[model samples]
Target: MDKFDKKILSSLHENARISYAELARRVNLSAPAIADRIEKLERTGVITGYHAQIDPTKAGLPILCMIELTVKHLDYYVVLERIRNMPQVLECASITGTSGLMMKVAVDTMPSLQTLIAQLMQFGDTKTSIIIDMPVPPRMPQLLADD
Candidate 1:
């Protein structure tokens, strides 16, 4: 990727909904060139997908929590599959720690959280922490001009 590609990526990261003409304006390229570059980026898997950022509180899932799960012996794949099917599970990761999986979850009520925890506990031990605040929220990485 050249400077134009990097600029295009940065512009898209800020606003994926931007029109071809607008993107071209920002990147100082023609609309057709912009479209061609974007298509290339997507085809090359550099551009994965576009998404809308939603506010969890307004979406009626006010409770945010982090769950650390210590999977039972030979249950890693099973636990991962189950977690993947759960709608409340926003994100899950395999990390280097005592816990095998860590997940960010959202729920409507305390009872719902308890129920989810109970379900996970059937597979292994669980440690849950209510997310009171997030000083730094999720954001895409910077695509430097030098990259």
Candidate 2:
């Protein structure tokens, strides 16, 4: 919530694997101070768990697609849960406008993509668009920072 906390968060967003000492080195604080600050950040929910940034193409997910879906006469949570359980599904979001749910899925090939789409049909009517390139990797939602 302070300047140093924002600095700690910014540094972590770039490299979550940094050690407390190393983070301290970058953030200009003592190792123990860094550790305590990080602990406080986590406890206060300013910092969450760290995660990996996977290379989806190399990880056998050569095809990445954005799926736009709309469901009828069903509880949204129920359908969302089913979509979450699908192996191909990577990310799912409920949004406004034309699409009710926006999801990202991976496939090895076009035939496999067809199968994935067919599976989604069991829950709702859907539209999909394959990703050709991403200019920027998705970043964490920038919260509590003017910078």
lDDT of 2 by residue, 1-147 (tens): 777777888888999998888888888999999989999999988787998889889998899999998876566788878888898888988888877889998889999999988987877789999899999888866667555
* Candidate 1: stretches off by over 4 Å: 144-147
Best by TM-score: 1
**Structural similarity to truth (TM-score) of each candidate:** 0.93, 0.91
Clashing pairs in 1: none
Span of ten consecutive residues with least summed lDDT in model 2:
138-147
Off by over 4 Å in 2: 143-147
